[model samples]
Target: MLTIRRHLVDAIVEHARKDHPDEACGVIAGPAGSDRPERFVPMLNAARSPTFYEFDSMDLLHLYREMDDNDEEPVVIYHSHTATEAYPSRTDIGLANEPGAHYVLVSTRDEDTHEFRSFRIVDGEVTEEEVQVIDGE
Candidate 1:
């Protein structure tokens, strides 16, 4: 099972809604352990593509360096599907380099609006996981 903060889910939905026609992306940071293998703090990357997201290499480098400085590693990567379901695309699967990190998808294609899902892609295989959003104190 995958667990995420409620605020993180809201932020992802908001980002997806705000980015409408394009894809919005960001990073998830937290502890990845057996007891809580998927707990994260979502960080919105203001730097994103309006038509296509090509993970800003500079921003990625900065984020990595910052994480190193703070001693917190990026445990997951999230992106939105403006018009499609919350699932990985072929390109997404092909470009995913982190086998141990969670891949989250937020879908904003319906009238009700918010939908979030999490998955893991390893060796070209995609496995969906249940996400339980926990309200933080």
Candidate 2:
């Protein structure tokens, strides 16, 4: 299960909505080994495609460096799907290198509804997980 704050969820949804038609990608970092998500780091989708998302290589490197300096790790890695369900594609499972991170997908396929889902992708295997959103601070 992935337990996260409500405000964080709202923030992610907003980012996704803002980037509709092009996938929005980002990470939520937290203290190493804490399994908590506290910092929202919105990222550029290098691909800028409605069906795909790729973090800019330079930005990813910088983010890793900063997270290291701050003693943080990416607890949640997220992306948006403009016209699809909130589920991982085959490419997503193949590209998931962080076995410990929660992979979140937000779908903005409908104007009236948003689909938010979380998964764990390890070694080409995808496992859907429970998400518990807590009240905002």
TM-scores of the candidates are 0.83, 0.98
User: Could you list the CA RMSD of all candidates, in the order they appear?
Assistant: 3.0, 0.6
What lDDT score is found at residue 27 in candidate 2?
A: 99
Per-residue accuracy of model 2 over 9-110 as CA lDDT, tens digit each:
999999999999899999999999999999999999999899899999999999999999999999999999899899999889888999999999999999
Query: Over the stretch 63-130, how does candidate 1's per-residue lDDT look in tens digits?
Result: 77876776666666888877778899998899788887778888777848667889899988999988
State the RMSD for candidate 2.
0.6
Error of 1 at 16 (Å): 1.1
Whole-model lDDT, model 1: 0.72
How displaced is residue 26 in candidate 1, in Å?
A: 0.3
Task: Tell me how far the alpha carbon of residue 33 in candidate 1 is from the true structure, in angstroms, after superposition.
Answer: 5.6
lDDT values of the candidates? 0.72, 0.96
- Model 1 residue runs over 4 Å out of place are 31-51
